[model samples]
Target chain A: MAQGQHHIIPIRMLAIVFGLLLFLTLATVITAQIDLGLVNVPLALAIAGSKAILVALVFMALKYDNKVNLLVLVLGVVFAVVFLALTLADTELRGTIGITEPGTTELTVEPAESE
Target chain B: MSSTGTTLKHYFVNHEQQFDAAKLGMWLFLVTEILLFSGMFVAYAVYRSWHPEVFAQASELLDWRLGALNTVVLLASSFTVALSIHFVQKGENDKVVVLLLMTLLCAAIFMVVKYFEYSGKFAHGVFPGAGFEPQGIIDGKDYSKYDIPFAPQFFSIYFVMTGIHGVHVLVGMGVFVWLVTRVARGHFSPQWYTPVELTGLYWHLVDIIWIFLFPLLYLI
Candidate 1:
């Protein structure tokens, strides 16, 4: 196919990607079943992200398609990351910044009682 | 428009340019879809972070087994859609119709499972928003125990996210049915199957969203 034309992907490649996606789906479920403490969520997300990438690259034919479309996809994902990261930065750091009343940190030093 | 069905528009120099333009437009629209779902993901993350314990306890009420089943069904549907595109490119219109039918069947199966899951939740008094109550016990897990603080948030997000995604699936089914008729009429061929390719991309994106949803909501 000419550059930037309708390029046909091999059925074999698509099948392989599909198999990989199914395998990762099982992996995520299995890992979720196992309690790995802090690792569990991140691990599941990583696997899920990989599956998404696979679908975008292979099944969506981004790999064989124009680079401009790939650029668009990448930029979209980047902005999404920025949105999530900035929002979490604010939400996670809410109480610690910019709004503490002065006396809230300590009780009034009770005056030493006199006779 | 030209006499030949596959001819390019006057605005485009050639067929490749026209196809690329259409594909680019589709990708732009898909990006907007990503941004749309990201807002909900942010909500999910914020709420889950604030109430980890509540989220964990609440998620237990969702049957992960059913979620996993839906995940597999969606992935299979995505695969079939991809295969349809492959057959279309090869000019195998009959096989393309068959694969598209398989995709539609999978979408139906996914929705039926979702219906059961939603009704099951409703039967237990588990609902979104103002009606957030869980009562009775099923499968030996007391639903009443899930009626804790911020638990409503979990189910609300669950219903909203999955409900919207379910709507997408229904829309996809409608589009596929239309495509099936068009394919039977021989509207797509190796030289020009832009609609099939674009629709396949859209279907895969719906599947991708579910891949993340299955993990975040059910496996939490």
Candidate 2:
């Protein structure tokens, strides 16, 4: 391929990524079924994140595409993380008065009676 | 039919510039899409953290098996879309058409499964928002038992997120249908197949969203 021409990914590489995504899907399902305490959420998120990245990089052809496009994606993701982080920081810390008390508060919605 | 290819627009200096510009525009749109879905993700994170137990209990009402099935279906569709682009780049219109059809099939299958899942919830009176009511028991797991506070929030988020995602899937199916007709009419070729490529990007992004949604919502 020429310098500016589209890079054609091989069929084998596409198949490989497909297989990896499917494997990860199964892995996340199985891992979630297992009792991993606090590890489960993060592990599931990590696996899901991996699957997203794989789809973005390979299937979306961001790997061989323009660097500017990749920059756009990275910036979007960064801003998303920032958005999540800032919002979480506020929600997680709101109403906390003392330094010693960690704000692990729950919503005070009264538990409804079972009908 | 194979002889026809996209003509370069007057503004773009060359085919590469045109392709790059088109792709960049699509990426920007995709960024907007990311931000759009990010709002819901933020809601999910905040709510789940506040009511972890409620989220856990509410999530049990969802069938991870169905979620996993849809995840695999979406991934397979994404792969087919990639393959279609591959063949389009190779000027193999026949294979491209076939792959796009396969992609459409997968998308349809996803929606069908989602329909069943949604209807199943509705049948159990597990509606979102003000209609939040659950009745009876299935498989010995009483739906009525899960009618706790913040449980509605779980089902609400589930409905909104998956409902919006399902809309995207339907939209993707429509786009693929159009692309199928175009591919059949030989509107794409190795020289220029921007539409096919852009559609693939959109479809893959939809798949990416589901990847997160599955683990977060169903796997809990």
Candidate 3:
């Protein structure tokens, strides 16, 4: 191997990132306990996304690593998002293409009561 | 070049090229890992949206306290793994071994907690698919009331996601044990700690997936 210099992350920085991650975990739990109605799922996901980014960027050393590696990760994430969005588009819109107008119910059975 | 004690492979011009190639390969592997989990995530999304109320009520049966505990456990393990990489680069094999041990311990704890949670659910006869027959009382709550339509789907998704994640944890533990042995034998140095670095990245990805799973399965 060529004599390549490796960047040593400071102990203090690692400690701080760890602390922040723990704090965010606590935040997500507390926020979940409260009823946020429409914002609940998005809120939980946002917190998770932030935590994932921190782990990827700092804990995994992507922040200080080569750009090519970062590009690989970013591409992976982008494709995952594409997979989600396109699939959801199809699933969520199932049976909505009829000429009798969307939102029309074909089955007369009442939906089961939940809870 | 002799000062660093780093060996250059004949196939590569220098260590930087070799390191970059390895790192990129790991990232590609990580991408496949992400896609692998994405299929489950898609299933989760489709089912949850289709049966929001059922998903919500069924999720309530899960103990978030245990989930939170595991979350903390995984995050701490991820921290220790990261620290291990840092120490490896500093040529502190002793610290690396200790940190790797800590990471392994955390993974064990997470699995143990999961075992208890699974046992509790099983005791109530709550299972995925056709086997679901939730009965008896758990934590003063009546499990018998969870027989609503689409409830099975919720439990199915839950079991599949967590079960796979647990398997990953086990795999990580195996890798860490191997790493500990290698470190103890003085096999790693500041010059070539690629295994430690790659293993850390894999562990962090495990942690990241759990970060999403915790909220989606337990809190939501």
Candidate 4:
């Protein structure tokens, strides 16, 4: 056998993770039905995030895999967050930047009118 | 040389190196898949933030029970795929074939449920883009009541996201069927199961994407 020949994950651990995932799914549904004001989206995302981590770690066997693979997965997730955050920053604050100077607009307008 | 010298290609030094390279490639591919879906998630977030009430109301037209059922089905499929990998490691080819078939069955069930959900929506003229006309009664609620401004955007995103995800499910079914055939032919063993592991990773990622989609599209 080779050095990395086998790493059989116990069936019990897989079952436990599967159970937890189902439980979290139910929890998210119950929470969503209630009006949680602004916290609803974040709460649901948090639950989903945990479930994703569980799948990646146990079911996918990243926990027992090589470090480089884990690093690759983490980088992928980090870039995804960067994409989400940067895009949201722009869309969420579209009009709040106030890039237009109050007097500059009028000055340019006057020149254009005179011409 | 590794025990399965026939399985190791000439370019690779040993089975371990080949496995590492293949796994790395799969991870890179998974990264691309993440970014591919991220674009849709961003679109969803921007639109939902703009029309929170409309998205909320529009999402209600979706039956969360169905969404949750598919979620359970996918989670179970992911579990079975994981077990198949475990069995492959132990050289239990029969168990591996059975598990892959089970995973394939789950994928088929997921698609069938999606078919029902999509048809139900289309029957009400609830389509993406300008075709959206929420008429007819669903779950005893008047669909016409949901025809608010920007509701079309909500449905458009819904259809596009789930539609792409559904396509992935179909592709997974094909992959599993092929895998099952190979397993029954005794092509994989403890020393050479790269394809099985790679496909399992792909399937798990498909499941992970739905984990987020279920909440974003159906619940919240």
Candidate 5:
């Protein structure tokens, strides 16, 4: 509170943000219950990211603390995101599924059938 | 400077540096933990995409309402754990003890919830082996071929990931108990309260792990 005592974001604002996180998560789950195609993961991540930012900035009191620590924390999440993205790209690119382009020879090797 | 002597000045300086380094080091370690768990999350995502039906069936088998409750409990405990650190920084040992107790109680409740959930799964033969029934979907209709929740392989990963997380919760409870004992014995002060700070980092790691796990395991 010392650092942000004079100009810190209001506690009420934080409380509202937390409340919103709960509601958004609930909404996301309900939305998932319905078929939303491929929007589910990204939508869910959006809600999670919002909630995470709130927890980090407010409940964890990173706002009152040093900015360096907060940046380090954010960097971790960013790196995780990048890691997931790259892995997904690798997996998707290696195995082309449901795609039939010209001059395409897609190999579908069944592990069990190989034996 | 062979680092052989032990004067108060030298000790204090070393302690200060180590203590300061501890927080940063813990943060880096936490980042690594996040990335490690992220692997499971990615695996879960890819499998779910490929086997949406089985994953959904498996999710329905889970007690999601209980999972939601536990999630809130953890989020609240993070608040208390943070407050414990705050009290320590402000030279409020009594408050720190109260917050620590609350945090420990929250952890106990988490474990209790998890115990019931696991026991229920065990009762349903949810474990890997012949117990697992594979439910494959055909077209967009109801094709109940064994109706296995995800694949047997998927269940294995689920158990491993959640099982590891459950261990962390137990570890957190143990650490909380230690904090409570030390607080009761008047061990922490504003000048020397590294335990509370370090513990906060650990609890936050627990919370962060759940933040990812909840969605990967339940929501989607």
Candidate 6:
């Protein structure tokens, strides 16, 4: 065939990558039940990142695509997701001025004559 | 017919022209599909940000085992489909059939897992539309359950993305079957396998969609 042709991912490697992908997804799902706060975001992102890489490199034969093509594809995704983050930033910029815990009430006490 | 001879017109003006144009066209189309899905991603981001708790709570309803399995199945199918292309290019008809069948099997597995997952949720009243309910009668305190109306909206997007993807899988299977029929009839040759190359690109596109979808919908 042609030189620098796309490489065919072996079935064995495919199986291994998929196994890991499924396992991580399952792990992330189970982990979601826990109240880990910010840790949840990172954990979810990590699993998704791994799966995305596997699909890109192994399945799509991205490793075979020339540098320019990869640049276009990767940049598109980056910009798209970043757009979402920018939208989120708007909400984050608003200070929590009026928003308060339901039970948080302030008390005003008279000054005591402590001498 | 190409500018080349009548016999050579079957492929390209030349072999170099044949592969590059096909590959380029495929990539450009794929970019469009990416941006299309990007719209949904943007919507998802907006909703998730607005109702982080609801999105998370709704997501928690999904069976991760099935999602994980589908991810793996698709990855494997991608490999098999790539192998099918490889075999077809090499003029290994038997190998191509084997790989294509394997890829189809993977799709079947995905559908089966999806069937069970969707059905199980149906029984629990966790379906796509008005069927979903949050409280499972835990502790009988009539818990608020943190339920959010906007959450199932994500599942609607999720099913639409994946449902479209599943249709692509079926279409991919049809393409493979056609290839098998052609191969059985000896219509393909080592010198000309544009169909295989084109089908490989299509299959890869399907895989690419899932690669993004898996993360966007399932992960967070």
Q: How do all models score by TM-score?
A: 0.93, 0.92, 0.92, 0.92, 0.78, 0.74
lDDT per residue as tens, model 6, B19-80: 66666677677777777777777777777777777776666566555676787787778777
For candidate 5, what is the DockQ-based docking class?
Answer: acceptable
User: Which 10 successive residues of model 4 chain B have the least lDDT summed?
Assistant: B1-10
B88-131, model 5: which lDDT tens digit per residue?
76667788889888998898898899889777666555676556
Candidate 2 at residue B204, lDDT? Answer: 95
lDDT for A84 (candidate 1):
96
Quote the lDDT for A66 in model 3: 89
Model 4, span B1-220: residue lDDT tens: 2335346689999868888898999999999999999999999999998899999889999999999999999999999999998888898999999999999999999999999999999999999999999898867899999988999999999999999999999998999999899889888778788889999999999999999999999998
Which prediction has the highest DockQ against the true structure? Answer: 4
Which is the better candidate, 1 or 6, if ranked by TM-score? 1
Per residue, candidate 3 scores C-alpha lDDT tens digits across B1-220 of 1323246678987787887778889999999999999999999999998899999899999999999999999999999999999888888899999999999999999999999999999888888889999999878889999988999999999999999999999999999999899899888878788888899999999999999999999998
Q: Kindly provide the TM-score of model 1 when superposed on the true structure, using C-alpha atoms.
A: 0.93
Q: For candidate 2, give the lDDT.
A: 0.91
Q: Give the TM-score of candidate 3.
A: 0.92
What's model 1's overall lDDT?
A: 0.90
Order of models, best DockQ first: 4, 3, 1, 2, 5, 6
> Interface RMSD for each candidate model?
2.3, 2.2, 1.5, 1.3, 4.7, 3.3
lDDT of 2 by residue, B33-99 (tens): 9999999999999999999999999999999999999999999999999999888888899999999
Docking quality category of candidate 4 according to DockQ thresholds: medium
Candidate 2 has what TM-score? 0.92
Better of 4 and 5 by lDDT: 4
**TM-score for chain A, candidates 1 onward in order:** 0.79, 0.78, 0.80, 0.79, 0.62, 0.68
RMSD of each: 4.4, 5.8, 5.4, 3.4, 6.6, 8.2
Candidates in order have lDDT scores of 0.90, 0.91, 0.90, 0.91, 0.70, 0.67
Candidate 5 per-residue lDDT, tens place, A2-105, comes to 21122234446545655765676677667767778789778877777777776776765567655667778889888878877887787667666654554454
User: Which model, 3 or 6, shows the larger DockQ?
Assistant: 3
lDDT of 6 by residue, A8-108 (tens): 45667666766776677667667766768788777767766776677667655677665566776777777777777786676666555445654443533
Model 1 chain A poorest ten-residue lDDT run: A101-110
